[model samples]
Target: MPTSENTFHLGLTMAGAVSAGCYTSGVIDYLFEVLDLWEKAKRGNVQGIDQNLVPKHNVIIDAMGGTSAGGMTTIISTLYALKGKLKPVKKIPENPMENQNVLYDSWVHLDDNEEKTFKKIWDVDDLDGELTSLFNSKVIDAIATKALDMGGDVNDFESYVSENLPRFISKDLEILLSHTLLRGIPLSVDFKTEIARRLKNSPMHNTFEHYLVSHFKLNSGNPVNENSYLWFNPFKEKYSDKIKLSTISTGAFPIGLAYRKFDNTQFSDEYIKSVTRRVIFGDFGSENPDVNHDIELNNYPENYSSISVDGGAINNEPYREVGSILRSKFHKDENEYQNYGLIMIDPFPDNDDIERKYKEPKNLLKVVPAIIQTLWNQAKVKRKEMLEQYNHDFFKGVIYPIKHRIINGEYKGRDKNPIISASFNAFGGFLDVNFRVHDFFLGRNNARNFVQYFGCIPYDPDNGNVHPIHREWTNEMVEKFKVSRRGDERIFLPIIPDLNLLLEGKEPGDDKYNYTYKGKPKYNPSELFKLKDNIYNRFKKVLDKGFDSFGEKTEEESETPISDALIRREYRRNWFQRMGDNVKSWVVGKFKNPVKKAIASMLSKFVIKSILEDLEQMEVLDDKAN
Candidate 1:
């Protein structure tokens, strides 16, 4: 509910990351906290709220779009935003040290009865008769359990025996095989069915449908003759449904490759070959694959109906959706909001590094999987290139490039765009509790840093006004700061001062006296004065409290999560490391329970001590600087 004179028409587009979406959820958790968008919605108020309200204040968002796993993020996050369930269960203290205590204490200390902080942000209650069902219910568990249970029917012992073993086999042998081969049926069909069923049952689903319908109405009458706000890339043209949007958007390979209900389409040999070529080489083939990209909604079948798959197969990063929607908004005379920006959050920035084997496949067995991987990698690379261009072109927006490691590399439009980096060890599996906890905190802390340094005011497009905690700088002011510090070499420093007197229209002279340049200077006198004043004011605002504290390390910035050591070292492990660890863990579990327990206990203590020492060392560094 934050109000701002420089309010932004924020449009968000998230990048897909399979299980790594836990990290993305953490990012959204913190963003919602800063925006203070946790107020619950009442009956009839949730739907059509964005259009009904006058163009007066920041609401939830102007447009919500993503692909594959990111599409799931859009649905889940938007659901939370609408239901007013985004606030953190634990209060974040004002004191930095106190905040650190909350973070570490929650993770390190044991609490079985109480829900973990990460689970709170990620889980929501199932909507039933209870009005507070969402408050107490855990969303991830509910959906996962239902998806697993109803996804496939349980196989009976007789059926299993008949399917896998010969009828002539001995009764005892058949029973043994049945017990060993006790697996359920294929889950893809059931999984999609479960997702649709849940959506249909929930009232929030109705609210979301209303929201989309309203957007469709607003975007329909435009002169461009295209829908502006809502989009999802289905494979074949079909009828659109609010319930199906979430399902279709998430129907990528592995998850929903056989989702053939809407189109009655089969993955024939020729169809796959053609699809692979387009996916791997892009629309124009390898020579000019990057140009004339064909995944935008504009290229969709003339009708709104279509059976879809994971949109990532076509466009992994749907940032163009933001651009397209904003353009439509800009052209619409009825649209009242002036300021606009895209908040593009990419969870899988490093996915381009997931390459296929450089050498040719050794056998026919590896060919199909290899081709699929090559296609995936090539598609990701193309979209990543497009994302880079999008960021450069839309330099007035906000960008969150979540990373697994902290680095000093300069991002595109650093001086123009409000780019905030949230780094942490995102190696934990998708449903890992420890990873979710650490990731949530990592996101929250970095969000605090964003508000402190960049001063991005969070605006909700569906809701009304909330005051901003701090002021944000305009592009002109930021450009001047870069110009004034043109010669400064320091990289880690957040703020830099003018290094040359000539830039300020002053002559370089001896220490004894100051000299003003009477001759024509490099810059206009008035411009130079304004630059100096801006730099001085920025320094006062950012660094007056303490220079050392300006860029002091937070938990995410300083060290990898403790869970990284205990659960998985990192996400980028090679096949050998993964196989070795699996074998080693199995061996230890089977033969050395005591040894495994001892190692875990010792490792936990060692990691905790190391973290404390590192934090203390940072404090000492701060003290010495002061």
Candidate 2:
């Protein structure tokens, strides 16, 4: 049972995306600001910062979870929170002559005379550019140089294809595969190297559990009960080297695509193939590896046979982990109005995929890659749907979903889901400092907007301090606010007075209405009528557009909700059935990943071969024409 002092449990779960992690960093930065935690955390860790370690106090999140790129974000956020440092937020100075503040307005400046400022608004910044430069120099540039030193560049394949039009048309792709294989080594090495360098001097370099203790009771100076610091990372197999490898493991693409060994025999052919097979087919020990056990590399040679890959490949969203934390921690409370809730930051919210319609294949062999790609994408969408259904069934009212706002700016480009989609083709914007600055501000502003409308319901649901948006029946707040369906965007509604009640109140002393005998419609008759009328109008509008009011559909206009009972029944297996479900899940898990792996393997092996075969046929036809 939770103590009165620590009654509430709040968890934050972040979803994965590659370069879009900067947006999540911005969201966390704003959350810290809202909680007023930076100053309090920093005051306790003056010495820790000097040693380049995270601070030891003032953490507000009870449980935190993330996967893939979100795994990197989670680690970086935890480190910065402990260190009391904000992720760099700065835009390039513009219009120097018109406004000097625009010229040199940033938390970080280019010169020694300048100082770093901690401002609430992240409009100005030079620190972000400096960090990007460091990442380029330490990681990106190093990988490019290594690729060149290997006797060829990945771009050489494109060059070869363009120069030999007849060969490309004929489907010759020998040069393509040769270039593709060279990319894996350099990228993996530099990524791991950069991650290591960032965390080299950290104090708690073991399990996440050891690192995330009760910060408020650090040295026994305070007399508070130990706070439950529940944390979940989908990157399995954490050991003493977790500090160096946790983020890398979670973000590693599968089947040795982005894997690097820190051992002397890393380059051997047999070693590489063995690790590949192990990752694709073998298990990562158990669903939850013993958190307390430290598996030493040398002693556990068998355990080291398999390597960790992208957590997104298995569990892109950490919904299950977070749900478990809530269940285990608060099951004993038994209160109808529980003081526990989860806030989810979803980078990839469900959207209708604009799938391409391919013409009938001239040859069946030519269609394998297309088929594989479709299946992979479909699997991801299906997985998200299943998770959404499960959460809706079990934790609908408690879970608050926060979708990242579309990055708005000159560089916003075509990618609406900037939290997950990397718009590589965007003009000078993505490459410019201002683009990243916009992402930081985008996440910050999104968080600000989210807090204004949604929050955990107080233990006392009625007469509690609810946001104005939720206070429809209150006398003071009734005229000021509106309530919309869960699916619709919140909009204001006009207040409709109960004329009968108003007239009855006007005649105070008259016993004509028999006030004591009749109940006054339990609050408001006109308000209920107005709400029902609004729903009918919305339903009618959808019907006129030829869309079924009862069906689920995604449109350019709005999202229509489906039947609630259907969603609830889809993924109903819960704690009561955990014993039987675990066995069933284990069996399904065995074949699920290998099926995905087989599709990926077949695509890689056959696609280039088919191209080459077609190229030869084209060459033969040219000879006959000549």
Candidate 3:
């Protein structure tokens, strides 16, 4: 049985996008703030704040979910928290590089050039060498093992290839074969073993065993099972043992990474005969695993029959899962649901004109408009379906009202009403109409006195600006305005400062800042760097609170302090690793288009010729037998 904790239900879900890192960082920052506030309140340092406002550490998170890059963040955060290594929230410096260094120093302990260590391990000077070694060792070994099991030697395979496929033998073809092997078998047993070793000591091992839900796919085309979902229950020792490998398999994007396969032991007795040869695998993200649009939210069939695709197929947000879980708990009369909070960290671009574009698919070309219109309609239906899943009452009170207000001209134009007229209204009118009415109705005497004493001054219609009449008593109005402004500031309090800087159209401190790309601001490097810093700072702030500075270690601290050089080395190492992965992805992507065409053209000719040649050889063998 899985261990359960009675804690407040705090469900966190993140959206998929390049900016997911930034959004996740902001969430971590908010969590740190909550932790800080709680600690301060306990110590009686934070005035006017209740300690209960901050959730206890044990009960802080009931469930968390994410998709794509956000999924990676979710796992990392959960693991760190379980290990009791969550850092505090602190303000990052303005210098982008400095912030970058801080991030490097914190996570993945090593200097930038530390990736060179891999070179030492592999006895390779460059990435190509490393790849070549990986393919030879992992890919060739697997093939050789399989061949041996089938009662064939390496020489037998070479002889079969020589006699049956003469045209396929060439220097270029050999290299392509190696590359193909690399793609076909991306993950090695050794790599999986290493991951398992790491997880053995991980603080999150127990939580992973109990609560982690991994989405995976079984090969639909295979004879054993047409289509099946691998819903791994980590609580089971059998499943827990393969959690790390399962995570990688599910999360690996299909673009560059090959589909991972596992031996289907269920069919071993009937299908394999002597050896279990049946394998099943596919992309977990297929058909939107997060939402699974075809099925009811609560109904997870024992054998999932849908084709897997990218999680972004139905929706980028993975909050539906969290919401469903929480709703189920609520229905079960779980007390934690009463104090539940949902935090959705969305990093995707939020365009105000999205609904407008959906409604009016205007294009210069007629066909283009038609295609766009079709897509827009489809998206609208998907959105509606998603909205329907949530509680109608909660939706109306929270999300529906915002949508209605934004569309109903509430967000546009200045306040034309003759009540609570203020000079510093940037958003034109107050968002809360009831509050405006309450101010005027409750303080009618004050309003009358002000008007009678100073005289009413109407806003200029031509200028469309509110120009309040300046009077000696107007200073009081200004003071009141300032007080109101303070209340408004609270809404922006939890916003990540680095995100604010980016929104202001300023460079947030990237080392290799590109001015523009294709006539648009190219702030990718800076944005990602800031995101890394944000995540790192939050972890450092919370976990390493006793440390005087980043590199310094107190006598009481058990962990060794990292040096500046080591930080730089580790950062370089990570950069190189990322570069290698990107290059491999790009190469594989380029190979796909051309290779498909070439294979189609060649296969038509090669198949016929090879079959005839094999038949002739069989006739000669028959003559010799006679």
Candidate 4:
């Protein structure tokens, strides 16, 4: 048995499912709930955990890995956790991204006034003209300025810029900028530099110093191998220059998106020559094989070149990476291994039955299903390998398998398959119900199953009667567990209000059950207040000076429309007559319900016919004059 001094490691793995947008949202919501639950458990607010299951302390994540969108989520979650911003909150909103205040309050925290400032920047009543003006003033002007400096034609540069920076930026840039700004990082000429600087200066930098973002060689002919892999450690002084740039480069998907390239100066002549100067970067998933493989045998290539791709092509789930790192560090002792726990959050769509409903394989919509199936198959293979490894004493009984539950709503003609049902559920509800289902499943089923599966009770061979892990709980039990008594007054606020309302005695739509901040303030006063002021001041400066100096528009004076006397006279007569007839018909219809049909008929013929005749005569006159 391990002593109290020995601490167990917890590895977190996030899975890639690029097309499963809603599924990803559900996964995020699930993560938020888990964090909240963990916080409660640490404070002794929750009761599901038995003595054997309870950690001596709050379990710290030893390692974290992810691929593609999963990678992005992992980074965001890790940052939040490290910053101590993973607070207990309300249930996740329908679109987690849109509800930044709740899902990512740490990243985009706003005061009452800051909210108004952001609204001013983003709230465009005339979307088209404002958007067009914004593009011309910002994107077009920047490209044009850079092009002129490089002695390139404006037309050619515009085309190139459009190709490199497509419409996706229009959707994503604002949100990204908003996040960066909230983090107190200013937008500069070189964004990568600013990001690197911010990372280095961040108080939580030590927490993520060992973080790795895996990339692959895009131009490599062979499938992803050890040589093809390029692991980026952003905190390392040597790779610091390219770390932030490489992270984004690795995430840039190849399909329907431009592959990123290092500005020519970043590469050495020899390095450039070796790769034939074809510098292109794509998603790490392009090289992810998505199978269970021994990471011990793999090698990291010595050279750092320009070409890179997604990790999903080789491994959508990077648990192998986390496992390998742990094994390397503590392979000598079996007891050491038992101390660590691994939690993988896989949101990839993995249903075949629902996919089969769509017969056309070549259609654009089929691509998502195909990717889901491929990733699902990979996960299955990896799960099988994990079970085999456990039997062989490789994992040493550390692995816990949870069955995937499909959460499709109870609707007629719904696909019965769990995978398909989950996908449809995620897609149709935009992750609102999907998140609820995910939380419910974990509380009601997965938690109990996990406890039973990994219970410490020894099996009796005499009568073949094994003592079951007593993890069963009712709605009331869960509610009781969520309530915390730290002071004179018990804090009955639940992390997820909807869950409490639905499961507990709380009334439906009761806001009182919602979580609220009442203890010591989580944020530092100086940092929080200063960061907000800094961001707002910087934003105001940018707006005043314009995004770029060139292509600035001056307000134009309004002009009055030229009206014709004959047309106005004819139009007024038609309008008044039409209004009068409508009013008369309405009054007649109201007074005589039985005779309404007769009145409508008379109006349609006598009133509508005259209007149509007059409109035809006006059209003839207008056309002849033209």
Against the correct fold, how does model 1 do in TM-score? 0.38
| lDDT of candidate 1 over 305-369, digit per residue (tens) | 22334456545565554444544443223323334455656655543345675677889888989
lDDT of 4 at 493: 22
Q: How does each model score on lDDT?
A: 0.34, 0.34, 0.30, 0.34
Point out the higher-scoring one by TM-score: 2 or 3: 2
The clash count for each model shown is 20, 6, 23, 21
Model 2 misplaced stretches (Cα beyond 4 Å): 1-6, 37-59, 85-241, 253-257, 261-303, 332-335, 354-366, 374-421, 425-430, 456-626
Q: How does model 4 score by TM-score? A: 0.37
Q: What clash count does candidate 1 reach?
A: 20
Q: Answer with 3 or 4, whichever has the higher TM-score.
A: 4
lDDT of 3 at 402: 10
TM-score of 3: 0.35
lDDT of 4: 0.34
For model 4, how does the per-residue alpha-carbon lDDT over 1-626 read when each residue is reduced to its tens digit?
A: 22323333345566654323223333444444554554455456666453333333322344555665455545444333322234433443344234342323311121112232222322233233322221112211221122112222233323333343211111111000000000111111223455675674433221101112333221111222333343222223333244344434334333211233453344333332222211111112223333353112112223323333344544566665555444443344543324344455554434457655655578769888898877646533555446645632332222111333223432233222222112221221111222223332222232222222231222232444221111222344334333433462322322122223222434422322122211111112232232343333333333433433434676775353355555676677667888999999789657654454344345334432443243233221122321
Q: Give the worst 10-residue stretch by lDDT in candidate 1.
A: 173-182
